[model samples]
Target: MNESELIARYFAPLAGPAGLGLIDDAACLIPPPGCDLVLTADALVAGRHFFAEDPPDAIAAKTLGVNLSDLAAKGAEPLGYLLSLALPPDWTERFLDEFSRGLGEAAAAAGVALLGGDTVATSGPLTLSITALGAVPHGAMIRRSGARAGDLIYVTGTIGDAALGLSLRRREIAGGALPAWAKTLDAAELIDRYLRPRPRLALTPALRACARAAMDVSDGLIGDVRALMRASGVAAQLDLARLPLSAPARAALAADPALLESVVTGGDDYEIVCAVAPERAALFEQLADAAGVAVTRIGAAAAQESVLGPDGAARRFARDRFSHV
Candidate 1:
């Protein structure tokens, strides 16, 4: 039998409140009175999410971060999580130690305890899965379907830094010329961002109030926002000039104008994309200020079924940001 089938037969039935019923990433759990349960899971496989040579600690951290990002999108506070892990038989002890360190650091950052998990040997490749559970107030969970046509769209942190970071790492591995953004950044920073991204749980409480809709930017900014628009039955218009580009991203764009496409369409940015009402702009600004986070108003929603750019014309995205198929 295949691995998936074996898991279904033996592992799935064994899951309960003590174990998730294999319905989703992590377990759909319960919390105290007035609390809402939130669950999310993510998996990373060698040759898929990371290169074999990538640091194990970074890999473990990223696996957790991706799951945490999903919980943040729902405006949930990190409660605890389960780790289902497998490592190749040949993986080094040093690698495992670093990997555990990274994972431990990320969990602590979210204020979550590592409740329980399973570890196994694997001949295929190093793989890690994290199922994060969180709690929010009853009826307070943010979703992707509440945006109105006139709502304004905002993104937290910056838009394109992580994508640009990935490009720099790939160039270095291929022995190609470094991108200008790479030149300005410490090489380690770029590589680490590509691997160990920070989850936006801190922004969730603020967003729970102002945001009409929200989603984490696992896919590219454009594609993720598009999902929000689709869910809310609205169209969006973005002022290209308003995108939150990092200083290094601007430098890269100045050096090689063609790289703008990557900045827009590349995925794996863990920032939050959310919509707020036009009147709530000031309130959002205040909330973000109190939280010491910046929320950029990049665009607004329109009834028309298109996204317009700076010149007030529709811009066609070059590619779909993330797709399982």
Candidate 2:
């Protein structure tokens, strides 16, 4: 059997309800009355999602966080998850302790459980896969296909920080010293965003109320937002002047103006990118403010296929999509 086929036959039985026969891209779970089931999955591989030498606990936390983030986009309260792990022999002790600690901590924070999964030895690089299950009220789940022309586009949290952190990591790999800005910042948080990104679960209710369309920024903002537009059969016009660049990122941009494009196209932000009707824009602002999460209206949906800049100039977005392959 192929890799996924093997998972379906051997692991599906062990996965219980969340497996859904391992048939669809995601399992369809039925929730209680007045509720909807939300399903999302994320997989991480060494040298791709993370480096082999990175801390195991951090990697574990990030794997879970990305999955949780998926549920967050649908306004789902996490229920539980299944894990599939591939480990090499040398990584046993440290990997176990750190990975378990990270996973346990994220599960507790997200109010989820580590229900069941499989562990196997592999000659390939370490890999971790997590499938998170959650529940939202019926008709309350947000979707990427609900946007319309003239809807205002919004995003949560700061962008570009995680990409910056990755650049710093690359510098470290090249035997260069950490830059000054990197030295003063919280390496753990930066690395955590790189490793563990908290899914914005808290923003779901607010999103459902005010968002016409929504998605998490796993791919770069430009690319993911474009996907949302495509899914909804629309286009977009972005105000490049309003992108919420973090202070450090601003500093980095000061050094190199070209970084602006990187900030726009780089991925792993994990923040929510949403669309709101013009009338609901104020409500969204209030909700985001009350929740203490930064939200910015950076663009608007159009009935065309391309995104425009503030000056009415056509700006190119990332052509590449994030892929497991």
Candidate 3:
């Protein structure tokens, strides 16, 4: 299908009322009284952010899901989103069908609707760009710069599932080396975690209620925490053993301790990292628990950024970022 025809057929039905039925060049948004708007955008390219052979539905979910994660980190409720999809010439109808289906499902689940955006044919790889909008109370949006010394740091969900899943996706591990967590080491579940990130939107109420500072862990945990510390003009004291690991991840680490570094420094964990004041840490965890979200205290904000190893010595990571990926 051509650009206009494709958009009208596949995307128009997903537009929100503010989207002007996808007939206008611009979308309208009016924030609620005493509320601040949150905006986040993410771009995904085939063969870079995702495998070219990945299902169109998964690509659509991840493209929008990552953006929602940013909003979640800021303690905002998703409002609406704009999508710009670029399709290669060889794209098929089946691809568009499933991609749009995924987009609609994810948007509805996140309480967001489609706003207006562009669609075009690209000679390059399949690319998706989404600009998501969210809402929060005035002066209530959590920021990376709000952390202070003596605050406790918490990370939502487990870490490194996505990173380990990527390894399985690349066929990096041998068949005989499955983890004890599962007969197949729950390989499909790991891969699904990589493809479909669980944005902690439900945890936002707790974050807004108690978090002093917050940011989503997109890059490696160590690098993202360091970035948050730098933004807050404070330091962090982290315990390596405190890092929460899923059962499969724990089993994998037991089999090969070397994977620990990769777990700490690989990308796409997509969990929220937040700093809560000492007095509020208990309430934060309580709220998170009520929301059915698992949060673990891994460290505290300090005068200097330090990570302690299991041997009770300060250890340094070879790289702060996802350079390994």
Candidate 4:
């Protein structure tokens, strides 16, 4: 099918009212009264972001879910999104069908609707990009620069699952060397964490009410935490032992403790990390619990410009996190 027919058949039903049935050249969006709009964009390209053989549905979810993650960190409620797709010559109609089905499901789950977008042919690889829009009460949007010295640092859910999952998918980890528990771990669960990340939208209200500063962990924890610190003009002291790990990850680490470095420094974790004042930490945890998201306090901010380790000593990593550069 051609581009127009492709959208009309597979994507039009996903459009919101503001999408104008995706017939117009542009979409129209209006924020609620006394609220400010929040916007974020993310892109995924095959071979670079996902394996070439990954499912189209998963690719669609990741493309949109990553953008939703940004809104969650900013304490915004999602409204709608625009998608742009670049199709490789080898792409089939079946691929588009599954891709749109997954995209539609993700949009519904996030309480957002499709706006409008573009599709084009590409000679390189399949590429998907999404620009998500959300809203927050006026002047209430959380920021990465609001963290203060002495504020406690917290992360939602566990970390490093996606990173390790990617390693497994890429065959970088020797499956035979893993512990029995690790070997028995369901491959689908680990890989699903990598492919279909659950954005912490449920925690947005709590973050708006309690977090001093927040950002989603797209890059590795170590690098993203440092980014937060630098943005807030503060340093942090993290306890490596305190970094939350999933059971599979824990089992893998038990087999090889050195995997801790990979766990801490790898990326693609869509969890949220935030700074909260020491006094407000308890309330924040309570609110997050009510939202059904598990949180853990891993460190605190300081006036220095360094990240310390569990030994209360400053340490350096050969590579802190993933960099597109």
Candidate 5:
């Protein structure tokens, strides 16, 4: 079908009044009184972001969830999102149907409406981008520069699950043989973590109430921590032992300790990492418990550079981060 027919049949229903039924060339948004607008955008490309055979629903979830993760880290509530989709010449109706359904369901669950965007045909790979809009109280948006000396570094959810999950997924995608350790771990769970990223939106309340600085862990945890610390103009020492790891991750690490480096540097984890003043620790924990999200105290931010390992001094790590050049 053509873009107009596709929009009217599959996407128009997803739009809010601000989108003007996608009939208008532009979207109009009015933020809540006394609130500031928060905007974030992310893109996903075929083969790079997800396997071609992966479920359309999972792709939609991750495409939008990654953007929402940024808003959550900033302690903002999603207002709406603009979606741009580029489909290859041979794109199928089934893919479009499933993808739109997944995207609609995710937007509804997040209380975000669809704004107007462009849809076009592409000769290259299928691609999608979302520019999400959120609202936070004026001057209250969390940033990566507010942390102070002596602040405790805290992270939401387990680290390295998505990274390990991605590795497991690669093996499956390439039809490679799984190693002995792979048989012992929860492969399904790890793959799910990689495919469906859970943005820590529930923890925003506590974060806004207590966190000094915040950012999402889309990159490796160690790398993200370093980024946050650099932004705050402070050095930090993370306790490798205190990193919260999922059962599968722990089992994988136990089988081969070398996987520890991959776990630390492999990206794709959408969890939130933040700095909390020592005095606000109790309140933060209380709020997190109320929200049903587990948070772990990983380390402290100060003017130092001595990380501690599980059994001794910090173990030397290779490539603390991964990035696309």
Candidate 6:
């Protein structure tokens, strides 16, 4: 099918009232009273972001999910998004079917709709970009520069699973050599995390109410935390032992303890990391708990410009995260 037919058949149904049924050249948005619009964009490229052979649905989900993650960190409610999909010349209709299905499912789950988008044929790899729009109460959007000294640093959900999953998918780690406990590790689960990251939208309200500063962990916890600290002009002391890990990740680490660096430094986690005031930490935790999302306090802001380890000593790594350049 051509671009117009492709969108009319697969994407039109996913548009919201503001989307103009995917027919208009532009979309409309009207923020609620006493609210400000929040905007974020993310792009995914084949082979670089995901395997060229990864499922179309997963690619669709990741393309939008990463953008949603940004809104979540800013404590904003998702409204809609604009997509720019670049399809290779040889892509099949079946691929479009599955890709649009995945995008629709993810958009529905997040309560977001497609506002408008452009579709084009490309000579290189399949490339997808999305600009997501959300809203928060005026002056209430969380920021990466609002953290203060003595504020507690917290992260939602576990870290590093997606990075590990990428290693497995790339055959960097031999599946046959995995330990017994790690052998039973659900490969699908790990791969799913890598492909379809969960944006912490459910925690937005708590973040808006209690977080001093916030940003989603897209490029490894360590690097992203360091960026947050730099943005806030503060230092941090993180207890490596307190870094939350999933059962599969724990088993993988037990078999190869050296993977710790990759766990903390590899990217694509898509979880929220925020700083909360000491007095408000309790209420933040309570609200997060009520939302049924796990939140862990792993560190606190400091006056210096370094990141310290569990040993209370400054630490440095070869590389803190993935760099596009």
lDDT by residue (136-165, candidate 1, tens digit) is: 899888999999999999988777777777
Cα deviation in Å at residue 107, candidate 2? 1.5
Displacement of residue 193 (Cα, Å) in model 4 is 0.7
Scored by TM-score, the top model is 5
lDDT of 2 by residue, 78-147 (tens): 8878888887756655567666776767777877666566677788999888878788888888889999
Candidate 5, residues 1-325, lDDT tens digits: the string is: 6778989987898899899999888999877999999999999988888777789889988999999999999999999999999988878889878988988988888888899888999999888999999999999999999999899999999989888888888899889977667788889999999998898889989999999999999879888888999999997789989989999999998898778777877888899999999999999999999999999999899987566766667666677787755
**101: Cα error in model 3, Å:** 0.7
Give per-residue CA lDDT, model 4, range 222-312, as digits (tens). 9999999889999877876677888888777777666777778888999999999988988999999999999999889998756555456
Q: Estimate each model's TM-score.
A: 0.86, 0.85, 0.94, 0.94, 0.97, 0.95
Off by over 4 Å in 5: none
Model 6 is weakest, by summed lDDT over 10 consecutive residues, at 172-181
RMSD of 3: 2.4
- Tell me which of candidates 1 and 6 scores higher on TM-score: 6
Rank list by lDDT: 5, 6, 3, 4, 2, 1
Measured over all alpha carbons after superposition, the RMSD of each candidate to the real structure, in angstroms, is 5.7, 5.7, 2.4, 2.3, 1.2, 2.2
Model 5 score (lDDT): 0.89
Clashes counted in candidate 2 amount to 1
Stretches of candidate 4 exceeding 4 Å from the true structure: 172-182, 305-315
- Over the full model, what C-alpha lDDT does candidate 6 score relative to the true structure? 0.88
Using lDDT as the measure, the top candidate is 5
Candidate lDDT (C-alpha), each = 0.77, 0.77, 0.88, 0.87, 0.89, 0.88
lDDT of candidate model 3 versus the reference: 0.88
Give one digit per residue, the lDDT tens place, for model 3 in 1-325.
Answer: 5667888888988888988888888988777878999999989899788877777888899999999999999999999999998889898999999999999988888988898899888999999999999999999999999999999999999988898887776663344554443343567777787888889999999999999999999888999999998899998899988899988788778777778887888878899999999999889999999999999999999998899865567889898776423
lDDT of 6 by residue, 1-325 (tens): 6777888998898899999998888998777889899999888888899887888899999999999999999999998999998988789889989999999999999999999999999999999999999999999899899999999999999998998888777663233453343576776677678888999999998998899999999998998999998899997778777888998888778777767788889999999999999999999999999999899999999986555554566667789888865
